[model samples]
Target: MSANGGDSKVAVLVDCDNATPEILEFALRVVPQFGRVVLRRGYGNHTTLANRWQEALVRLAFTPCLQYQYAAGKNTSDIALALDAMEALFDERADTFCLVTSDSDFAYLCRKLRERGATVHIVGEAKSPDALRNASDQFFEWVPPTVKATSEQIPALIQKAEGSKKDDAKAVAKHRPLFVVEAVKLLAAETVEGKVQLGPLGTYLRRTYPSFSPKIYGHSGLMAMLNTYDRLTVEQVVKGSWLVSLSEASGK
Candidate 1:
């Protein structure tokens, strides 16, 4: 009872086999944006949950739904998760459901939940299939934090890459996504001063491209990634608040 005026109930179900425990925090943050998360559950086999996810589950206060494998090559965890989601839907325990997985098998489950008048959100990796992403009402691409470069080191890294013909420069350009540049310009045009807030910019990018992530471009976060490009201008209007706009050269 602590989000969106404590009215909407959100259920977050994680498929541990498909996603890692490190993404738990990111997934939880996404829940509050929609509503108060009432149910937090993680479904996995004995080995999957016990070995890697035990600490995260306890820290996040998530109920562990363990599924034993009776036969080889069978994912019983998926069945258990789907059953619980249906139960929650029928029992009116939650109006919104967030499935944290990249598996396309849950596409059917997402559609079923939506058919029953429930909002379905997906928090998964860049590898999530189009079927699964499209099934959910909103899809958030979970970009695992980069281990190579810290956020503080990004500005220096950006400076080092400028006008270089080395392999490193090619590597950076290879991961640079064009969709981000396009989104900033498109979103900026709708505003009075051609500036877009960080929150809405991120939401629009995630909604339009389910796999969009700054980590893919070797940046720690969105701001670091935006700073890599010269065609975009990022400014801090308030503490922890950012405004992004297209540069004069790139704007229409």
Candidate 2:
């Protein structure tokens, strides 16, 4: 913990088998959402694959953990990832852990981290295993292939809600009153089995909705505004940061 009582160090463990290269890129871009991804590693059976990811791994500067098949039905990658996570924990090199994979095998690892007071954030496909999602302090679902960005600008949505134009009728009808709805939609879409990282959600909102200034809405920042919305749920994960979701609001 820092002087501010914040967990700023992070370790990102990627299961190359269960995660897409594109989602990995998107996930890394949002690392600052929680803190810094100080230790980055990718675990897979790289020796045999000889695929695109092998070359991609070198370019991305990820420490590769090459696992060999021990038996016909065994996957050593999951065990390797878990071992590394524990090593990072014991070494005291990270205060928070980011697990990027859809494997439920990591559920135990996430629970273990939380037990030791380390913040765990999970990122995976929309249909990721539920046990893994529930184990993390926060989790994010990778965007689905079906979700496409609309042509309408975010500013237009805000303006239509605040303006008195009849043309605003369609925009108003099509959009939610607050940016939180868009935020929630994004969360819902990316949530792997209904899990989303509050930290990354906040980061994504800021990047995608820059004009959503909390000052304009008479709040200090985005988190405050999110808390005020009855449609949103916020959980304090580690001091200043929160795990946000719409499940509570939707009564799921």
Candidate 3:
């Protein structure tokens, strides 16, 4: 998704065979950030849809695209999803697409979508491969609700597990990539106060790195991840807005 916002008709196609019912919530939450979602569909066989996804499909208002396997082991759902996406593209129903799956098989689909001038965003789990992540314009890692912790709770959990603040900081820093800090510095340089708003900083990071995710560093969200860093400070400038800047120890 582009940093500059506009009305881009979005088609959200979920591979129910590859993605769980829990991830649908996260996919829906983030899809609106790109544009108004025009099409929401889930593709799977009869057993797949009936088992755990029937309730989720109805609750989320996703039209089910049922594809029964003619062969014993062959996955016909993927082919059906790919075909529907291409049809939506040719029909001019969507300019942006969200492929909700972690499977690398969709990398080719992403490439084709991009070639035809469609913006593709892949919303998948942390286990999503580099090939799939790289193929899309943006990749949003879907952290399960059970594992998601608030910014306030993450530190307490870290403290209880590590038993030392120093060790906790080290562990977090080791997992966090250098590009996150570099991105902060880059965005901060443009501001007169040498500080970047948390919202825009997150947008900048996502735009700059498609695979970048707070979940990769064991944090639930951007604020939680940023709060773990010792070299940066996050302070609320108003009720809901936060300002993120380098700490004095960073010497930047």
Candidate 4:
């Protein structure tokens, strides 16, 4: 259970052959916003990817399920991952699932999981099939985190610090609470019948936009964050469940 009283538990499954390490890191960061990640597994040909993924897998504490490619062109890991996901779903280990893959083959799997009342989130690349991305409750495009500009990229930063102080403040000031509120308001188009469930909306915003942070805006959780926005309204239709609708944000 989270401090915010989140009851949902998430199972994170990664198809290592289909996504990069940076994306996997980003996925893990976003999953916590939805719920606790009870199980973490990465499927791939570990023997072949040892040099590239060993340190990362170990550092992230992800259990690597090795699936070797016996043939010239075959995705043995995909089958393994699908099987495990089905078993976990049937076992009711978690109500939320995150598939970190760009493979279209899992699109049908996403539909089946949703039919069983599980919220499926896909962390995929921009090139991932639209069907696969749309099949899930939420889709997140992986973006490599930006680092500080290097001396080679901006030589002037190292040479002159006097005038750069104002520029740095300007950059930092752009990430105000209003920016997140505006984003939430814009997402009204994505809602169903003009309503957005808090759980899924939180998952969508956090996964879709990695830079979004409730803490930065001085909120404890997604509901708390949305509570501050007058343009949105939140209601508890049932115990421990929330629904948000576009109020003045919709501009109706």
Candidate 5:
């Protein structure tokens, strides 16, 4: 990180099979929160992938790791990513790691990074499994920059309400508030009071979901967005200071 604490040296690794060029771009944008992105690399079976990925990675100055499938029904891309992560860890090439993929296969990789005391940030589609998202220090959902996000783009994966568990897709489509609830629940668990402070809450949300904004949800600001949800309780203890608690119905 920079002397003032606004910079960090980061290495961004991508699972090309499960990610798109745009998603990688979004993740790159968020990496600066931790520090400068010093290294960029992507792993995939480049032979079969669309040229756009190869073109994008190169254009962005990322090392394109080509992992060929040795045999039929084999996934070599994940293995390449895993090995590279371990190499980067031992080599001390980067202080922080940003993994861009929605696949649960990388869950163990994220866990290992955390175990080694490295900051692990995951950028993936919201349908990512509960275990996968919770494994990282933070998980970012890739919300498209323009146009409203459709249910297909972000399915409410974890923290489904009682009645909604049976069909999470419908829940995400019917009630978009669960997205915020899920992230809040994750942060709330680490706090002793089970309440997330306003400042840290916004910071975490922004750091995790770079595209997050109240206006995207039709609200003026973070507080306004929190107020619109019945599952959350937003309280102000001082001017420009507040606390957010997940309501009982939130199933925190």
Candidate 6:
């Protein structure tokens, strides 16, 4: 997350034709890693398909954009999704984007967004096209559907684990903790032009490094851990979310 404490603004666009409704539920669980889903829109010809998604879509507050197929073999849903994505980008409504689909058509859209300096996350099934996966800043494959944990569970787990240390103090004492430094380096390497969303950095850091929790180091959150280091700088964008950057002088 950004050194400054704020949320990143994100737009979530769902391609219903190529994505399952259950995937939407899975994808939403991890979206907070980027920012808030300030704008949510989905495109598909709902008439041809019958599923529980119709009710779920409204319950989830998704703005469904109807795209009826023009002919027997034509695919209009992809076109609709592309148009909406371009409109969102041109309007500057979101700083990051989440594309929830497995179709390769969105591979071009992902590249276009990153070219324009927007972070893109792709969430789809494991068999998602490689081109789309490559275009995303990070990609996640959906697992079997499960009930989501309550918000309180995360903090409670952190609190309970504070007293435990997997490594001995002597082992840790020989080296200064470099979680923040390593996280920044990893993000820079993965991002274009040494920039990445603060949200994805946190996800990557946790997944790649063991014993890298901010709470374990006496900090309540990722931003707090980043603040402890002078080499990192954080900025607050529009929605009180943070964007983190490495200071040029620090040479990190």
Highest lDDT among the candidates is held by which one?
3
lDDT accuracy of residue 7 in candidate 4: 80
Better of 4 and 5 by TM-score: 5
- Cand. 5 Cα-lDDT: 0.74
Rank candidates, TM-score, best first.
3, 5, 1, 4, 2, 6
**Model 4 accuracy (lDDT, Cα):** 0.72
Worst 10 residues of 4 by lDDT: 150-159
- Tell me the deviation in Å of residue 188 in model 6: 15
Model 5 / residue 26 / CA error / Å: 1.9
Clashes in model 5: which pairs? 1-7, 7-35, 8-35, 8-36
Candidate 5 structure quality by residue, lDDT tens digits, 118-197: 88888887668867877887677887656445443433222336875545434333334567887778788888988888
* CA lDDT of every candidate: 0.81, 0.68, 0.84, 0.72, 0.74, 0.70
Query: How should the candidates be ordered by lDDT, best one leading?
Result: 3, 1, 5, 4, 6, 2
- Candidate 1 residue pairs that clash: none
- Cα lDDT of candidate 6 equals 0.70
Candidate 3 lDDT: 0.84
lDDT of 3 by residue, 1-252 (tens): 556446788999999999999989878878887888899999999999999899999999999989999999999999999999999999999989999999999999999999999999998886789899889988877766567443212233343454565555555653666777888888999999999999899888876677666754656689988887888899998899999998899989
TM-scores for all candidates: the values are 0.61, 0.59, 0.66, 0.59, 0.64, 0.58
- Give candidate 4's error at residue 200 in angstroms: 12
Assess the local accuracy of residue 117 in candidate 1 as a C-alpha lDDT between 0 and 100. 92
Cα lDDT tens digits for candidate 2, 1-252: 234224578888888888777667766764666776789888888643357467666777888888999897788999989888888888889878888988888898888888887888887775676677677765666664456323232222234334554444443333334667666766766667454666677666654543234533444456666767677677776787666777555665
